[model samples]
Target: MYRGRLAYRPRSETANKIREVNKMKEGIHPNYYQAKVVCNCGNEFVTGSTKKDIHVEVCSKCHSFYTGQQKAAAARGRIDKFNRKYGIQ
Candidate 1:
């Protein structure tokens, strides 16, 4: 739940049946097709070896706050949830 609302609830089988009237979609992205990824920082490089540009929004050298941004966000969210649950805030 989030802000007094369900974040993820299973959809009913009937809900799945309803389809969009306009069923149009694009193909795979061309950039993703490329085997190599060059970070804007020009400090690091990633290839198919590392499971494709992942776990990072930007390279460490380019981003103002690198390495712990994702971790910090998650920590803050968890702390907020705990506070709400225990009236600690």
Candidate 2:
């Protein structure tokens, strides 16, 4: 509903008929290309995309979650902060 007005929706039969009669506009969609994705950690992969080339800083190969390093680093930071605040070695 818009502005408290009931929304208009076609019935199932009408909707099916409209779908059969209408079709997607040609030449309006971007072309899919075999895109080359380059990661900062030297990881490269090919995937379908509208763009031909893509550059990224991180990839699954070196991501902290994939390597299981983010949690350790975060915990170490918290522990250090707590220790400093309490003047503990």
Candidate 3:
């Protein structure tokens, strides 16, 4: 025991062997469907998901970052203002 709790120990291979095939309960898990995704930029793709149809505002096809259309902001903060004011290199 360490830190008031028992430490983890690996079990032997024979001890970890299972005799029965464990199966998932039917009707309990959500049904996976070939989900249709529609983006606002008119990009469509099919993927597996619990939801049938999905609508998104932005996707990789039209996102500014993915499309390389993102603009870098000329962000000047207090440090920059101070440096410029004092003419610090």
Candidate 4:
């Protein structure tokens, strides 16, 4: 019986080389700087972005999907359609 021993695989040398070489040229790309994100719920955080400052309607701290508070806004639309079909105010 012939058996082969397991061998460790080495990382590829050119794995991320393409990305490094294709980086944006200096002064041509948008300026990346520290920007502040202000959420409507008063949650503020600093992150790196091209804009100096950003205002977001929702964030992880207060977003419906993240906080498990999602409401069916589509349900209101359905209700409106039903009312229109039935001529109900």
Q: Indicate which candidate wins on TM-score.
A: 2
Q: How displaced is residue 81 in candidate 1, in Å?
A: 0.2
Clashing pairs in 3: none
* lDDT for each residue of candidate 2 in 1-89, tens digit (9 for 90 to 100): 45987879767898888988799888999999999999999999999999999999999999999999999999999999999999999
Instruction: Report, for all candidates in order, the number of backbone clashes.
Output: 0, 0, 0, 0
Q: What tens digits encode model 3's per-residue C-alpha lDDT throughout 1-89?
A: 45787779887665555422355567899889999999999999999999999999999999878876554322446667789999997
Per-candidate TM equals: 0.29, 0.74, 0.56, 0.50
lDDT of 3 at 20: 28
lDDT of 2: 0.95
Candidate 4: list runs displaced more than 4 Å. 1-24, 71-89
Model 3, position 63: C-alpha lDDT score: 88
Q: Relative to the unseen true structure, what is the C-alpha lDDT of residue 75 in candidate 3, on a scale of 0 to 100?
A: 40
Q: Name the weakest run of 10 consecutive residues (lDDT summed) in model 3.
A: 69-78
- Sort all candidates by TM-score, best to worst: 2, 3, 4, 1
Give the Å error, residue 2, model 4.
24
Off by over 4 Å in 3: 1-21, 72-89
What TM-score number comes out for model 4? Answer: 0.50
